[model samples]
Target: MNKGNEMAGPEKEILDGIATRSVYALGANAASTRYCFRVLRRFLGEGDVLELGPAEGLMTGLLQSTGRRITCVEGAEAFCLSLSARFPEVEVVQALFEEYRPDRQFGTIVMGHVLEHVEDPVAILKLAKGWLAPGGKLFAAVPNARSLHRQAGVIMGVLEAENALNDMDRRHGHRRVFDPESFRQAFLGAGLSIDFFGGYFLKPVSSGQIEANWSDAMLDAFMVLGERYPDIAGEIYVLASRPAP
Candidate 1:
């Protein structure tokens, strides 16, 4: 059995609490996967799309509906198998994104929370450049280690570290974290140009579904504040394009 697929005691406990206290939040975790896809559809008209690190295929279903040829590359065997079973029409490649490459070029490349975990972000971006056709876009998302929640948690002694959103000592720890400027530089060095980038969801992960009723108002306030001070947003979404000229 793949060890990563198995939930550890702490993770199981958290999931149990989430399921009991708020199924909506449990569901929202998967639902949030769609937000990036909406942004992708606007850019990718009618061509192939590449999705790296498609964990458990949460976003695969949404991409399938776009009518574009979708290729999902997953590192974990369990997730690849699950994704293949769910979307037979969609091509699922059971390989690490670092090793796998499609035969054809793509109009769009999508990845979420996959960058910081990789050993070499720049190398991966460079590799992805080959798969993109001219003017195609690469979309990526990751947690902001400098977010308000992380900062407050550090000061209040609620959390231990601020550099990485997740615990790195754990087997599943993220390898690196990025501020907007650093993140942009990584792509720039890879020959990709930034087309769009922004931070979002300026809230703590612990807040959960309890905020659902008032989240809109709360997020509005936080977003305004984050606009003035982006270090507070919990996560970021970025779009980089392969230069046409």
Candidate 2:
């Protein structure tokens, strides 16, 4: 799942101990986690990558597997320790995104599910763009307010609308939900042009509910369904790069 969904889990067992709630995290984990990386693999260059809010490193570890130099800026102290311990090579910087200032530019910057957590999305996005080398890639992913299941909920008379926030979203600390238009506005303001955009991982239900009941095969099919109906996908992503000089 996308970072906005706050889907969580690290490859190691250590993450399980620190998670505040296992069920919610499992649901978050189900969002665009793998598919985003897989799509990004096609566009990432051979430059250093900076990851904002690595969280439980569910996606962070996968980013590491790409075999590129990655620097993670995470606000959580315990998580920083965990990341440092697990991937020694990764330069894990412990700072809120607003306070972080790296010495050099990077080739790629990943903001997976990060904007919804921040107070000022455009500001942070501008800062991310500022750290980019020319032609650097900017990968942004967020939870889709108009995801497949959310719409279903609306049609079923369960949810008020796609934008309506639920208890899980509140618990996850999400400040806002995004549709493509709002998501695109942030990038346009930050001076990053959208090179590619789409949704992934169609969710017919919530993560915890699905995890408790669905099989692995069913989950895999959900991802395929997302590709087919991105407008209703669980999470939406945009792959962008710095504008031409």
Candidate 3:
């Protein structure tokens, strides 16, 4: 993935740099979806996979190697074009997730940390639910608003001036932030049964670096400890099943 730094494009080059830096600075996002594969592999079998918001085909390409037919739907024209060029073996669809209509169903769908940016998570989940075959699984991850560090930071801010840039930034365009309960409720309303829900990391991140930032040592420490004690994780990953008849 570090090779992403060598890829070229004006905006994409910059974003790719950030993505690459994020990997080195924060223990590599490969860790982000590692558990998803760990959990999904048990139930996915030799089934089809659908991935939403595949910006640069990083994870899409990863899923393709599992020997399952993979469909990657992305709204960005440049990204979709680049993905098609880079991974000709995988099927890439160009469209917003909200508008995409698959001609077939899938046994497993993995959506990582994409809901908070959606205008209607429930609608999207329901759409995903419709795409799944009976007994299919939906794997979703989201940021946890009630993270331990966030609460502590709030209290600390009460005593003195805090950095304005450090605030929970909704302006750059995330529609909603979710706590565990609220997130679970949305999934349930979409007709998926929650199989598991837990946090993944517990480090403090200022808003500026929310996308990526950390010392290499701290990143390693967080990865080891968070896997051991997932309860204090700052983000949540849930594996939910479509209700069985």
lDDT of each: 0.67, 0.77, 0.64
Q: Estimate each model's TM-score.
A: 0.77, 0.86, 0.75
Clashing pairs in 1: 148-232
C-alpha lDDT of candidate 3 relative to the true structure: 0.64
**Stretches > 4 Å off in candidate 1:** 1-28, 165-172, 204-231
Which candidate order results from sorting by TM-score in descending order? Answer: 2, 1, 3
Stretch of 10 with least lDDT, candidate 1: 17-26
Instruction: Decide which is better by lDDT, 2 or 3.
Output: 2
Candidate 2 lDDT by residue in tens digits, 1-245? 11122322331233333234423224547445766777677778878999997877777788889898989987656677877888888998866676777889999999888887677898999999899888788888888988877888889998888888777667666778898789888889888888988878888887778878978778878877887887778888888877887
- Residues 147-187 of candidate 3: C-alpha lDDT, one tens digit per residue: 55566666777412222223233332345667777888999
Flag the better candidate by lDDT, 1 or 2. Answer: 2
CA shift of 26, model 1, Å = 3.8
Evaluate residue 34 in candidate 2 and report its C-alpha lDDT on the 0 to 100 scale. Answer: 68
For candidate 2, the C-alpha RMSD (Å) to the true structure equals: 6.3
Q: Write the per-residue lDDT of candidate 1 for residues 1-245, one digit (tens) a residue.
A: 11233334553443333223322113334434455555456666557888887766667778888787888876655566767788888888765566575789888888877787677899999999889887778988776777776777788887777764444213334567777777888899999888877766565544444255555556456544544555566667678877766
